[model samples]
Target: MSEAVDPGVAATSEPKEEKPCVQCLVPEIMTAWNSARGACEFVPDEKGREECRKELEEIAKDVKSIKKGSEVIYKAIKSSSNPAAFIQAQIEFAKTHNAANTEAILKWADEMEKAGKEIPEDIAKIVKFYRIQAGSQI
Candidate 1:
């Protein structure tokens, strides 16, 4: 006969690590870029600074994708005064990026709620519209 396993000594599986938020990565990238800005002697020149600034702006735009995601999340939480054009932009992005889905959108909304932010009504309407349109089997 096999002996019973001890409950306290049973091996437990490790929890899956959470993915880093895109927004979270942006600040880190920004910090590194800014540090590069400070350390470069050539950056003292206007042209050099401008070039770095342009690159930084591009990175910021990428970071704005995270902002868009956050906006969608906000839309999910509560109604808003203004349409979340930015968030709508994100839904479009999700479609473009092949990331569109109710689960993903709802997850984004959940994230916003967890962060203590509410989705504005206007933005939610926009997101809802796009989602419905996307589902049509035309």
Candidate 2:
């Protein structure tokens, strides 16, 4: 005899599908690509260098598939050889996507200053404008 089933529950043999966490995937890809980039830089032999390059290329393809319009920023950050360049990419991304996030822009500007990297004149002007606007809001 069949058992009585609760009306609120449905019996199913299929397992629930899990969705990918995009936020987690972005950092994982970035870390992997950055590690491959370093390996490419320090590999002594031509063969090793070629292998690392291949790995980096694969990671680049993954980056492309992750999202549109933002892959350039990811590549810039991943391929940057120095902190200054990385921070520059961050600032540019903030300007493009988080223009209203004045606190973040200011924080990056401060970090650039601390790092002794010259902030671009246009970016400096933007920071100044934002600072003035923020002051007026108080």
Candidate with the greatest TM-score versus the true structure: 2
TM-score per candidate: 0.26, 0.35
Error of 2 at 13 (Å): 6.1
Q: Residue 47 in model 1: shift from native, Å?
A: 1.6
Regions of model 2 farther than 4 Å from truth:
3-10, 13-17, 62-138
Q: All candidates' lDDT scores?
A: 0.49, 0.61
Among all windows of 10 consecutive residues in model 1, the one with the lowest summed lDDT is 74-83
> Which residue pairs collide in model 2, if any?
none
For candidate 1, write residues 1-138 as lDDT tens digits. 977778886555687777677767666555544443332223334654455445444544555444433332342222212224323433444444444465577567667768999789886665566556569321
Report the number of clashing residue pairs per model: 7, 0
Please give, for residues 1-138, the per-residue lDDT of candidate 2 as tens digits.
988888987776588787567786777667545543643544455665565466467657766466433454455445544435444434554454455467899889889989999999999998888778778431
Q: How accurate is candidate 2 locally (lDDT)?
A: 0.61
